[model samples]
Target chain A: MRNILAIIERELRAYFTSPIAYVVLTIFVFLSGLFFRSILAQVLQMGLMSQLQAQQLGPRAMDMPGMITRGFLSTMSVILLFVMPMLTMGLFSEEKKRGTIELLLTAPLTDLQVVLGKFFAGVTFFIILLLTTWIPTGMLYLYSTPASGPILTAYLGLLLYGLALTAIGLFISTLTENQIIAAVLSFGTIMVLWLVDVLANNAESSTSKAVLTYLSILSHLDDFMKGVLSTSHIIFYMSLMLVALFLTYRSIDSLRWRG
Target chain B: MITVENLTKRYATKTAIESVSFQVEKGEILGFLGPNGAGKTTTMRIVVGFMPASDGTVRVDGFDVFENPLDVRRRIGYLPENPPLYPEMTVAGYLRFVAKIKGVPKEKIGAEVKRVMERVSITDVQERIIAKLSKGYKQRVGLAQALIGDPPVMILDEPTIGLDPKQIHEVRELIKGLAGNHTVVLSTHILPEVEQTCNRVVIIDRGKIVAIDTPQNLRFQLQGAERVFMEIQGPVPEITSKLKAMPGVIDVHTVGSNDGRHRFQIEGELKKDIRSDLARTVVQSGWGLYELQSASMSLEDIFLKLTTAEERE
Candidate 1:
């Protein structure tokens, strides 16, 4: 337990000591802020159009807070997809590149401690990233009364979704010593899983479509965004996270043998 | 104490170390001497639990490295050829982290880091970032990292490679000082380092140990005959012939000449002391005896001889 925290502390310092965390944070905040303003403007436009239509037709009610919550949740999910690789790309790759992996491997700490330490470090950074979004979401909560249930459920789903992606990035980082290669490979991999939904729609065979749709990384996310918390969707992301973490553990084991 | 038996590491392309076997006694400084690419690093890696041997058993402090790795690792400290350091961390910070991971208690981490830093004489630069430090300082920090937790055994690979001469001298002294309390296995291509620091030397060549012996014994065993170098200011052929006539002297030849003084290399029978006889013969013959000194085989020659002897076969 102490060894794991030691690793976690080292990793966190590594993240903040370098410009990686700041640059990723700034870009994420900037992009998310831009999307927030645009979504707010669209919501205002929709409210205006409905108000104008209500004077001519019968009275129609518009859920402004709900619209804002759903819009912000969906946009935040895509923004997270783009930024997660930056958070995890250097986890094992930098250690391998600088030859520090030997220190960890030769230390008294078990491989599981090291792996979980890194995974938790990445998760903690992802949580920090999630908290940054609260600035914009907090503005929504202050200006209007949005139902807290869907927003919290959506965030819970997004955290699971992010963990699975982080596991992918962490596993890929273990495969190579080059951070750029790790980043590009992880981005390409996550992109495929994200776009599987499109492939599912275009499939000619019903069974093939069903399998592809089930494999799509975003379809499960869509249910969470809609506030429909199904056990199967949660299970899918959990299983993916578990499998990726297991592969990362095995990769580290093989690295020791191959060394 | 560590024992390695039939250790071999075979990659897909070639074997790194082939059936290498050696043991390090408690409180012994074992110098692993080898040329570059001679599997010195590979053997140390396997011993330190940095990697696994293809077919072998490494028992460290009564625990097998492959089976009870944590037990073995707890007792050993390793410094690789390249210092395994996080460049962004401070020297003190890095040491503390290492101490923590090595299982030092939280209360003692402060003192452990300080102890290692003072041991390596890096306490002044403890606050400085590792990457900004010079190569010599970085090497010292790596040395300090290994000293943390005060493990029973230390494996240092080319510990003085990047340091300046003064730093190299200090590190050698430090390793020498670590003998009784901490068993050390240091690898190097520098022969003089092995001579000055190690109690026993393992000379590895081409992924195998060619020779393992005390420095003095290796020199004695490899030296076929006792040799004496002399500078005589007299007739070169006369001095050579006169020295060759001595009973214990096996052969004599003129080596070089300058300032009217000729250098003669006299080879005597094994374990014979012919320096006095050679000196007397030159002095009595009215030949000026400028210089006389015995020249034993240096470790460089033994290293070359052993490494190249395999090529001849």
Candidate 2:
């Protein structure tokens, strides 16, 4: 455990000392802000008050705080697909390129510790970047009453999405010494999963389409975004996280024997 | 203490090392000498547990390398040919990270890093980024990282490969100062470095051990008999015949003639001092002995003969 934390501390310090973390955070915040403003404009132009009045909804009909938070969550999730690869590209690839992987491999720490430490470090940084988006989301409370449940659920969904993608990125990073290749592969893999739902919708059988949709990370994330805490969605995200991490560990293990 | 027996490593169809074996006692400095691509690095990597041997048993301090890798790793410190370093990390930061992974206690990590930095004379550059440091300083930092955790054994692969003459001397001195405490296995293509630093030498060639002995012993074993090189102003035939008839002389051959002066290489039996005898015989024969010096086989000759002979076979 101590060794794991030591690796994590080194990784965290590396991320904080480099400019990549700040650049990622700035981009994430800017995109979140842009999406928030566009969502607010569409909500206001829809004049939701009349729709709620005709449906005998309360005076809180104009309160589209849930929709605003959902918009931020969806945009952040998409943004994460880009930012995660950038964050994890150097985790193992740069270490291999710089020959520092030998230093780590020869150390007393197990391969699992190195993989977990790096994975958690990337997750921590992603969470920190995600938190920066919440500041703008929190401002919604000042203008109108907002339900905290949906906001909290959306945050949970974003966190899971980030964790799953970061794991995939780390796995890709372990596959090569070239950071550019790692980044591109990681982004490409995440994009395929992100769009799997669109392809699944055209399946001939409903059951097959449902199975494919369930396998898509974005499909599971939709549950959390809508304030539905489904056990299956939680299991889906956790299973993907587990499989990605396991594959990463195996890749690093093979490197030790083959490198 | 380290022992390697019948180690073999094959990469695809190319064999890196084959049936190579050697042992190092406590506090012994073994120099691994070979030309480039002679499997010195491959053998060192196997001993250091960086790469597994295709077929062999390596025991470090009585722990089998493959069976108890963590134990072997804990007791061994390795510095590869290239100093593995993160370019963006500061010297201090990098050392501390190495210490952490090397299993140094948190409280002692700072002191350990400081001590290694001072030992390698990189204390002043601790705050500087590794990428910006000069090659010599980077090598020192590399050495410093290996020295962390104060392991009992150190495997340095061409520790001074890229240093200037002055830096090489400095690193040699530093390594010399580590004698009697650290069991060092240093591999290099530089023959003199083996003579200067190692108490024993292991000559490897084409993935095999050609010879393993002390520097002096290797030279002495390869030298057949005490010979002398002499230049004389005499007829080549007369000098050769006269030198051959001497009591102590075994054979004399005219090696070369420069400006009417004949240079003859004379070989004789061991324990024979033929320099004075040859000079007298040349003088008495009415030939001026311009130069008469004993020819000693250097370590370079022994290394070349061993490695090149293996190539022929």
Winning model by lDDT: 1
lDDT of 1 by residue, B240-279 (tens): 7777888988888888999999888888888888888777
Pairs of colliding residues, candidate 1? none
TM-score of each: 0.92, 0.92
Q: Clash totals for all models, in order?
A: 0, 0
Question: What is candidate 2's CA lDDT for residue B272?
Answer: 70
TM-score of chain A of 2: 0.93
What is the lDDT for B78 in model 1? 91
Which of the CAPRI classes, incorrect, acceptable, medium or high, describes model 2?
A: medium
Candidate 1 iRMSD, 1 decimal: 0.7
DockQ of each: 0.82, 0.61
TM-score of chain A of each: 0.98, 0.93
Model 2 per-residue lDDT tens digits across residues B121-203: 99999999999999999999999999999999999999999999999999999888887999999999998999999999999
Which CAPRI quality tier does the interface of model 1 achieve? high
